[model samples]
Target: MQKHIYILLTILSAGVLMGCEGYLDQKPRKSLVVPETLDDLQALLDNAVIMNSNVPGLGLLASDDVFMEEAGWAGLFAEMEQQTYLWRRDGGFEVIGEWNGAYQKVFYSNVVLERLHEMEEVVSANERGRWMALKGAALFFRGSAFYDLVRIFAQAYQPGVNDSEMGIPLKLTARVTERPGRATLEETYKQIIGDLNQAIEFLPVTASSLNRPNKPVAESLLADLHLQLGNYSMARDLSSSLLQAGTLLDFNELNPEDPFPVPFLNSEVLFQSVMAVYSFTFSSLVQVNPILQASYAANDLRGRIFLNRQNPQVVTFKGSYCGNFDYFAGISLNELYLINSEARIRTGDVAGGMEVLNTLLEKRFEAGTFQPLEASSVATALAFVLMERRKELLFRPSRWYDLRRLNNDSEYATTLVREMGGNTYILAPGDNRYVFPIPQVEVDQGMKQNP
Candidate 1:
């Protein structure tokens, strides 16, 4: 069964590697089935091949939240993993599979959406709603993939260069022959917001499992995207609405001594997806950043859930929601809460934001000892929210995005530094290195590459 899925994915991904010019000019294959049935379209979305897994792990690799010992860094067997850990902008990093994996998911989504309209003639009226929901799911998947790809590959979104900056190519159609160039940052985000808004309109309020996206899932993505774009009002309003359905897990109920502090499919997780496992970097020798560990208050339970002490001085991460190994990169109720709190604080609702942050922190800190945080001013409140956001969402593939967005604001901009083998590497704010190079294959095939 898996072999068949691989073959299907190969067929879907064939054009992703080539320049869009003459892409669909290939001869038709006898084995590939054009999605004609409702089940066939749904199967594309349901296929775990492109949908459930293989979202990039690049964010974690480049993030300051996770680090490695000298031996671990030296022992990295995969060339891509090693370059990624060093924050190298070289194109060799695409060998890690995120470039191909994410684009392939986008390809699958396009196939599902393009075929949905054709199914109307053969499908029954009663099932049209189901088909529409599937269409929405495909949109959600495509938007999500584009979201990941744009953030990783393009320069940070800046209002000043909104129309000129290069964003990932917006591949809306499934035509393998379509020749598409990189869209501007403004246009790319416009498409993402449009797809997500439509997805929210069509998705069911509830999903049967965390594996599928629901209305809340679409809402969460939009909220997160808004926060990244510095649209605090929109982010705050959207995330606040989700609070009705969002639930925060109480850390007190968890056993700290357990091998995995956060169990699989925890109540807080709204969607389920794991990043590609880079054991040579994550589970094997990667150590939690000392500064991040120190940020946790003495009474905070997140320190326990996010990091486990191998010895007093050496700690390793064990908080992956996958139970072990792979890192959980999905949206969750707790993330929505943080986004709402940050948006409120940024938008001058300091007291309201503090109250929201306290609600989540209370569940994370020791029961009776948890005191509510007080912010004397909006600046203080925003700073507190940002700090807590880092602590709350560590190793979840968000800190990289946070760094990118925050770097645009002088008040919050940070300069990242790494010392390796007696040399210092610095990633300064607004540095071109913030934009990862386009993958070698894309460049080799005539795609415009990031500067």
Candidate 2:
């Protein structure tokens, strides 16, 4: 049954991916059908092949959080993976997983949104709620896809500069021939935020499965979007409200000795999605950075629960919420705690921030060994929260996104360094390399490439 589901999903994914251009062109295809019924539209989004959460796989491969030893690099890394590790941009530089995956999902979303209006007349009053929910889900998926795409393909959103800065092509319609040019960063974010806010109003408060977006999920995405936009007060308000009703998986309750300590769909997870596992997180050769591992206090359960140390220096990630080797990139309650904590500190609520951070830390540290963290000033508390955020969320998709946004602030900016093949490569804050070049194929077709 699982194999059949896999085959079906593959076909569905290919159908969308291959048909994107043709669909946009409004060309008739024998293999494709315009979603004429509400179920037909909902079916497109239901196919997790297109909609299940994904992060830029290359971003994970290139992040500073993990490293490969020289021996491991030679023995285990693939050509594309190695190039990314070295931050080489010449050949094999297109980050296609994110580009292709996001647009595929966006294509399906545009189809759904276009068809929903057609379904209004046929949708009975009893089915109106279902139809609305489907429309909201479509908008949520579309907005989320664009959000992920712009983060990878465009420069970080600098408010004053965004109006003139290049962004990904914004596709609002399902027409296949809609040769739209890239929108400015400001316009792109406005479209994303607008879609999400409308999605919030139409989506149900709760979804039966984590596979679908709900009111809380939309809110979480909005809160995170606000954070990246540097709207600290908005981020704090939304995340705090989310935490009030969210559930966290207590580390004390988990068995640290288990190979995969956290169960799939754990309590902390608000939505669950994993990036394509391309030997990055699962391989013995790729391990957590030694310094990052050491940053964890002795009694902190996150290190013990999330890592498997095969030897003195080799530590691979194991605490994925997916239960398999795949890296979980979806939002969770723990991240909300960190987000709210940082927002409070940035907004000058020093004691409130510490309280939130301490509340989360107490659960992560061992019982009776944990000391409540107290900070004398906002800076001290903010620093502690940022460090803990890094320590707690390694291998999750947030690291790259965090680095991009944090690079704007000198206090939080980082210069990523990789030492391999007897060479040292440095990526300084605000470097153009921070924004990946647009895929070569897309650019060859006249899409403007990032400089």
Candidate 3:
């Protein structure tokens, strides 16, 4: 069964790569089996290797949280990695894993959804629950893939002014021959939100595994999207409602000596997914940004647990929530807490915001040496929350999205600088380069490229 699914996925991927037409016209072989049963569709979605892992890592590479020394920069295995790190504007780079990987997820979701729709008419009373769950899962996966694509390939979504900007193409069906050009930013977001809303209604309160989507996962993702859109009140309410379901890990109980101190599928994780692996991510020469590493206090257990000090002068990140070398890029309770805190502060509940922030921080610091953080004004409270957010979520794929949305506000805007081999490259806030150019292969197929 797994072999058949792989063959189907291979065919779908080839169709996508071959100009989205004619490839589907090839005669079906005996080995190629179209998914028609609930079990068959479920198995496809259950293939975590294809569905949950290898999300885009370009955003992490482009973000300012990590840096490479001159030697490390020169030693990178791929020219694409160096180009992404430098934030190059040219379209000379070829198709990357990030783009192909995300669209593969989209293809998988579309396949499941199309099959589910066909099976819906004949679904028996006993199988209704499974049917709904499968549909909800499909929508969640597709919405997630779209969200990641837009954040990397399109401009930051401004609520009122920039809704007309070109967003990633919305591939809603299994048909590869249909070329649905780029949708507007507004349409893309609406589709994402709509899918999640319906998914929330259909999904059970819990899933069998962390890799699967459930009601809480969908709601949390929706809240995250709201936070990104600057809808503070909505984000505040959603995150607050889900707070009781979260459990934070105490850093004091962890062993800092372990190469990966955090355990896989730990209490804080609400979902499980990993970033696409890049050679530089695990290279010895790559080090955590000095400023970010310096922000942790002496008593803060996170600094000790999250960073591996190679020598007096060097530090590299070893605290992936994945509990190994794989960089975790999934939603977590820690992230929700930060989101709730920031939303409360932004919505004029500074005191409430600080309280939530303190709760999470208490678990992060050494038990006896920790003190509750406070703020007298919204500005001060927001600053505290934002700082903790950066510290807690470092090395995740979110920094790029955070940079894009935060750059819209003059007070929060940031200018990223990278120096390598005696040359300094700067990316100003709101720079056009922030929106990565669509893969040249996609461009050659008539897709519009970013300027």
State TM-scores per candidate: 0.92, 0.93, 0.94
Model 3 stretches with alpha carbons more than 4 Å out: 1-30
Query: Residue 219's C-alpha lDDT in candidate 1?
Result: 90
Better of 2 and 3 by TM-score: 3
lDDT of each: 0.79, 0.79, 0.84
Candidate 2 residues 4-37, lDDT tens each? Answer: 1111122344543333332223333444444556
Give one digit per residue, the lDDT tens place, for model 3 in 293-332.
9999999998988899857476899999999989998889
Residue 269 in candidate 1 has what lDDT? 85
lDDT of 1 by residue, 1-451 (tens): 1112212333444454333422222333457766656776766677775687877777777779877777878877676777777778555455426666677777778777766766656768899788878978988999999899898888878666565788988878766566578898998999999999999998999987788899999999999999999888999999999986756789999888998888888888898887866655454577888999888888998888888876756778888777777788888888888999999988888999999999999999999999899998988898898999888887878898999989988999998888888888888888877777766666767788777
State which candidate has the highest TM-score: 3
TM-score of 3: 0.94
Worst 10 residues of 1 by lDDT: 1-10
Ordering by lDDT: 3, 1, 2
- Minimum summed lDDT over a 10-residue window in model 2 is located at 1-10
- Candidate 2 lands at a TM-score of 0.93
